[model samples]
Structure formats: C-alpha cells, structure tokens
Target: MRGLLLKLLFSLMLCLFILGTVLTAFVWYVFNYSDDRPRSSSHPIRKNPEADPSGVCKECRENTIDKMVEIHSHTWKKQEANFKKFRSQLTSRCHGATKAIVTQVNTPLESKIVYDGEKRKPLVVTPKLFSTFLKEQPFKNVTWETCAVVGNGGILLNSSCGEEIDSAHFVFRCNLPPLDKGYEKDVGNNTDLVTANPSILLEKFEGLMEHRRPFVESLSSYRDSMLLLPAFSYGHNTPVSLRALYTLQDFNSPVQPIFLNPEYLQSLARFWRAQGLRAMRLSTGLIVASLALELCTNVHIYGFWPFAQHPHDRRPLTNHYYDNRQSKKTVHAMPAEFAHLLRLHGQGVLRVHLGQCASGPR
Candidate 1:
C-alpha cells in the first residue's frame, strides 16, 4: 500500500511539470510569433493591419467601425472648435489686416500668358490652372520607385551625398533656391518634389526675395516635378503666399496642392490645444503630407526635430536649424514629446537622422 501511494504522487508531479511548460510556450508564441502569420477567416489568429491588410478579422472589423463612429460623433466637433480658437489667436496676435496685405502681395498669380493671341491675352499658365491640367493629364504606367526626403541641413554640405540624394528615382526638398552655391553642391540639383507649406515659406523667405528667385531657376532643371502646397489656414498663410508667388511667377513646374480632410485638422487642433498633446499633433502634418505622396516607396526625414540634442552634452536645444530662430527658452519645453519621436524612430516607421550624419553642422 505504501509503494502504490508513492508512485501515484510521482505521477502527479510529472503531470504538473508538463502543464507548466506547455503554458509557458503558449504565452511566448502568442506574444512573439503570432504576428508573423497570414490572417484569414479560417485562421483563428488575427494579424496587424499595417503589416497585412488581409489580417483583419470579424472582431477587429467591428471594433474599427465602433471607433470610427466615436471619432466622428464625439471627437470631431470638439476638434473643430479648438481649431477655430487657435485661428483666432493667430489673427489677433499677428494683426489680421497686415497679414492680409502680405498674403495679397505675395500670393501667386492665377495665370500668365504663355502665348500671344491676336485679340485677347494669350492663354496663360498658372500654378492653380497647371495643377488642374496635370490632373486631366493621364500618367503612363511605370514601376514603383523609392524616394528620399532631403532636408536643407548644413550637414549635407561637403558630405559627397549629392550622388546618393540624386540616386533615388525621386527626391523632395523644401524651397530650393535658384543659385546652386552653398549646400547645393552635395544636396544635388535633381528634385522631383518641393514641399511648400505657406507658413514655412513666409517665415523663411518673407524679406529675402532675391533668395527666392533661385528656386524658380532650379525648377527649370527637372523635367517632371511638383510644387506641393497645403490647404489654407491662419497658421499656414505665409507658406501659401510663397506658393502663390511662385505660381504667379510662371515657374512652369507642376503644382500639386493637397487639401487635408477637415476632420484630420480638427483632430490636430484638439490635440495641439491639449496640455500634453501638442508634440504628437506637430508631427501629424508631416505624416499626412507623406501619405499624399503615394508614389514614393520610402520616405526619409531630415532636419525635422524642432529641438535636437547638443553635441557636447546631449541635451535638447533650440539652436540647431538656421530656420528655427525662435528663442530656445520658450514657454513650452518638449522633452517628453521628443522622446516619443525617438520611440517612433526605433519602430522603423521614419528615419530621423538629425545630427548623426557628419557632413556639416546641423
């Protein structure tokens, strides 16, 4: 009787050990390997939508539908009001009438006479009309290609990166100057897309008209290119004016103006007004702009960090990019938010190489 009881106890211990091992293996598989498989109706496991569109299951679909309803009903209205308030602040602070004059004087022309007509002014080409024409123009079938988003960081200077930047099937920049002198030697002359945000343009080129002329000259170098524009808002008036001026000048380049959905802006406005949500909102515009360029396979970012770590101490400072002239000691400090951006870099969604490259000063 004693021997039989001992044998039964040993068997029970073995069974428990086996069960624990199996449970450990199941947990590991669920956390790590489950995301690797193809999702289908027949399969019980669901896949990530960003990795595989077909991985969505019935439950996930229902959850998405519910979330969409919540965003539209509860979130959108709140965002719209916040955006209006921000607009009001910009108008009141900047002096509405003066800003209007600046917009008018700098606005791009509607059309220009490219050819002379016998009686009426010859048919003109304007950025507004040019974009319309491009839409009507059908594109020939072509294989997908990679694109590089080059920032105007001094870091590219003397880096011998012109070849690399130009090697991409398509390249994008912001406000290319006409004369190819300073950092242009390494940055290259082949540009397929030029981003023209109204606020950025106004802030960068408001008084520097001579510097603006080269951008037009540079456009002449590329056979196919686009002047990217954003939809109008009080915060974006300056960039819009610069785009309008470029159009008025008859740069003869294709123009693509992206009108972001009002819903997206409303979300952004709410996010920005929130005490701790502004940094997330700040990068949302870049993400939105990147989405518009569906033609590009990969989009690399440069010179985007409003504040970058100083080389000596590795602390965030405002004195990196020439364009960011605002005092370093602003009312808002974004350390926590910048850390979130670094997390995004680790996720491989964007390549944020602000001061890492040794070509030039940031």
Candidate 2:
C-alpha cells in the first residue's frame, strides 16, 4: 500500500513538472520570438498592418488615428492654427513669397540668374528671354483663404479627396502630374500652379527640340495654370524651359510658364536646413508645402506618404499614383522629409491627409 501511494505521488509530480515546462516554453516563445510583450500605459500596442490586408477594418483605422494622432491618423480635424505666428516665422526665415517666382521686375535685362543646384553656373537674361517673364509676381494682389499642395504618392490611389481638394481657394501640384484618363476624380481638375521639373522636358518631350505639338497638347490638361519651372536651377534647364515657354506662346495656349527664383530656392533650402533637414536638396513637395504655408491662410497637404507599403494595409504601393516607377533613392531623403511634415501636422500648422476621404464633400 505504501509503494502504491508513493508511485501515484511521483506520477502526479512528473505530470505537474511536464505541464510547467510546457507553459514556460510557451511564455518564452511569446515574449522573445512572437509578437507578445508587456505594454505600458504610455506606449500602447501598435496595430500590425499585415493583419489587415483589406484596409477596410474600421476598428484598426480608429485605433491608429486615436492612439498616435500623427502619421497614421485616418481622420482629419481642422485645428485653429496660429496662422500669423507661423506665417511670420516663414516670412522672416525664408521670405518665401517676396521672390517666389522670377519675374521681369526681379530679373533685369542683363541680370545673372545663378543656378540653385549648380551655383557656379549662371544664366544671363537676354532681351528675348526677358519677354517671357510674367510682368509681376503671380497672385500678388489676391488672397487665398485655403490652399492645397497635392503630391503624387500612391496613397491617393482610391482616396476620394478630389471634391474637397477642388473646393480649396488655390490648388498646387508637383511635377505636372497627369489629371486625366480616369484620374481626375481622385486628383481633382483645379490647378492654380504646377511645378514642372526640367527632367520632364528632357525625358517626356525630348527636350522640346522636335515634336513640339505633343508638348503643347499636354498643357491642355492644366488649362491656363501657371507652369512653375526651375529654369535657373541648373544650367541645362534654361534651354528647355525657354523652349517650353516658346511652345506655349506659339500655340497661343493660356497656360503661362514662369521661372522659380534660384535665390528664393536657396533661401528656402537654408530655412529648412536651419530646422535640421539635411538632404541633397529639398524635395519639390517640401518646397511647395513651405510656400503654401506662407502663401495661404490654411494649407492642406495630400499624398505625401513616402513608404513602399500602405500604412494601414501593408500592400505594396507605387512611388506615384499614376505609375509604378520607383524614385531615385539617392536623390531625395524622402523618409526624413516626411518626418518633418508629420511634425508640422502634429503642431496643427498643416493638415496631412491619409487614408480615404469621406464619401461626401467637406
């Protein structure tokens, strides 16, 4: 009877030991390898985008927006921005609008236009070239209540933000993005100003040296919007920018081509550098966003995401909304630039739109 009781006790002890070992292994796996960790009240668990492939999970969206209230905010709330203070800072630091565009008044008949990118090279203004300059700055006497600076990131793929974007008093776009072929519903038709990189002329239009008619037709989509060109930014850009102006004028298209002041661009670069942004050059998005903050009372930014995967869905995204082409990683420090915008969004200086827009207009 004693041997029998001892055997039963030993068996029970072995079973308990086995169960405890199994439980310890599971706990170790979960804490060390698996995605389970103790959470502090200050740092909540971040939602994994991989788990929500459909991106329609409303709970994740709400939690993302509610918890961080920065980059992943699915909802946009208009905060009472200290417009005067912010505008004052921009003006004092960069003088953004003072010489925003190169005009006949700013560039003299024989003035040397220093290249912003290649500071050593400068373009001398000739009489014929001087004629293309706008008589004065654009929107000088007008006031814009709100402005939209639209980027071309694929985050805007299905975002129905077109109506809300068009409702802004002024709309600015980067890199002369296509606004047609079923894209107008998402990107909007209004463009008060659009920047045209010199590369576009070289790549898309073949330097405008031949087949100029195609270039003329492309301008039809912008419909009288000012073509902001960095004509003096590089030495090679001058000829092509001049050609674009001549093409528009020859065709008698309402679209106007204007040069961006290199000096203003340099100052703008310094302004951002002062804020600790160290990139080869500021991406066109950041430059335009800074300009919008100074030019308008309220600024709203769209499609500024720089990640390869969707913030909420983890699906692959094209570099741009219109194409799957990737950007040159070495050219721009995009992620770092986006971080600056995120800070601005947090401070209520600007509104960065993420996720899809509401069904109805704002």
Best by TM-score: 2
Residue 28 local lDDT, model 1: 94
Error of 1 at 358 (Å): 9.7
Q: lDDT of candidate 1?
A: 0.44
Which ranges in model 2 have alpha carbons more than 4 Å from their true place? Answer: 1-81, 359-362
What tens digits encode model 2's per-residue C-alpha lDDT throughout 82-177?
Answer: 556666878887766668898888788999888998978777888988888888887565568889999999988887888878889899999989
The clash count for each model shown is 14, 0
lDDT per residue as tens, model 1, 173-269: 7644331545445566677656555554556555334466654543565445655444333333433544555553465545433322222344334
Model 2 scores what on Cα lDDT? Answer: 0.82
For residue 238, what is the lDDT in candidate 2?
Answer: 87
Give model 1's TM-score versus the native structure. 0.43
